[model samples]
Target: MTSNDATRQALIVRGGWDGHQPVETTDSMIPFLERNGFAVRVEESTAIYADADYLATVDLILQVNTMSTIEKDEFAGLQAAVLNGTGMAGWHGGIADSYRNNADYLHMIGGQFAHHAGKDPAERTGEQSDNYIPYTVHISELGKTHPITQGIDDFDLVTEQYWVLSDEYNDVLATTTQSVRPWDAWNRPVTAPAIWTRQWGKGRIFVSAPGHRLEIIENPNVRTIIERGLLWAAR
Candidate 1:
């Protein structure tokens, strides 16, 4: 497909932990955005967040960034743009774990990655506890009707069960449960959100917790949800 620079604009700012393969993950989504009529640009730095005037011109932001610190003004500009109607979407730690110290950013995104209950994959030199665990996601009744999740059934992922500090504001679409194990500090299976959408002013926010690796992101249902979610979020 040809780039339609006049249709819409998107910015993908990616970096932080290499374990998440931010570059590769962000690269994989460029074609989707382009195919959907967005002229996408990739950036390696969060400094782009400081450019409010330029940000105002963007229609969407797909961030595959991780625990990178954001300058106060840069963070502020990002919040302003989203609140002013620029759509935001991301998966896993890229969106949920960004900026450990930025509360406003978390509020806009609607959640924060607390910690993964499982050990990290041995191949990666990052945080390790429980790296891979099989879990099933149950689609909510609302999800069956929501455009982002329409026709997608409940699926399973053998990745980390993200235990996020999320609020009730999100329009949850799917959920997963963590059965209490000997390693768990708490007993009883706990259900947590796997996919959700939220609003920040006039902008749309979509998040999915399953994309820990390229394979998971490439899953048919995962790809469809992410693609449709981004398109839906865009102005």
Candidate 2:
């Protein structure tokens, strides 16, 4: 189909570490997009860079990869596509934690997965990990009424609660407060954003810090949040 006739095309990039279970996670997302009338193309290899022209034709980009780097030209094309109105959306460390060497990429994403505080300290290296714990997310005042979060009740999750250091300009959708433990040496409590969306040029970025495992993404509330975030972030 021609570019004008391909409004439903979506590019799903899946690679990097197996811990994120890129293949399985992205496989699970196919039906959801299909149901929503999206013609999804799952690219397990990063060779899409060889044909940068084709990547620009997609309407939405969902990255399920983690801790991998892309060539500068390939990364630039994707960034430009999003900035020019293509939707960019992902959950957890896949998208947010990707392209650590590319500052321009981080600028497009709006925030980076900094650290996680819980039982799995050493395992929680970089952006992706198996740090599961029960926590509550407090909807940000600005996002309490946003479409991505409207009518969603405050929820709890037994998953990795990300402590993301975000750009001050982000439109925070929701946040989870991290309470200080009595045994912990840190004197003050820290509050972190659990989910957020931000506008970059003519495009959009949506991120949620949950998907550590298939079970976590299987949660009804988490599913809804991810679905809504995908739609909300689409241009």
lDDT values, one for every candidate: 0.86, 0.78
My TM-score estimates for the predictions, one after another, are: 0.93, 0.88
Across 1-235, the per-residue lDDT of candidate 1 in tens digits comes to 2385649999998898887888888788988888778888888999999999999998999898888889999998988998899999999999999898888888888888886776433445554424677888889999999999988899887778888778899999998887876766878877788899998998999998888878788988889999889998997
Q: How does residue 206 of candidate 2 score in lDDT?
A: 84
Backbone clash numbers for all candidates listed:
7, 0
Residue 169 error for model 1, in Å? 0.7
Clashing pairs in 2: none
Candidate 1 lowest-lDDT run of ten:
120-129
- Between which residue pairs do clashes occur in model 1? 118-129, 118-130, 119-129, 119-130, 119-131, 120-129, 120-131
lDDT of 2 by residue, 44-90 (tens): 86567446678667777888778888888787788778878888888
Model 2 misplaced stretches (Cα beyond 4 Å): 1-7, 120-130, 182-185
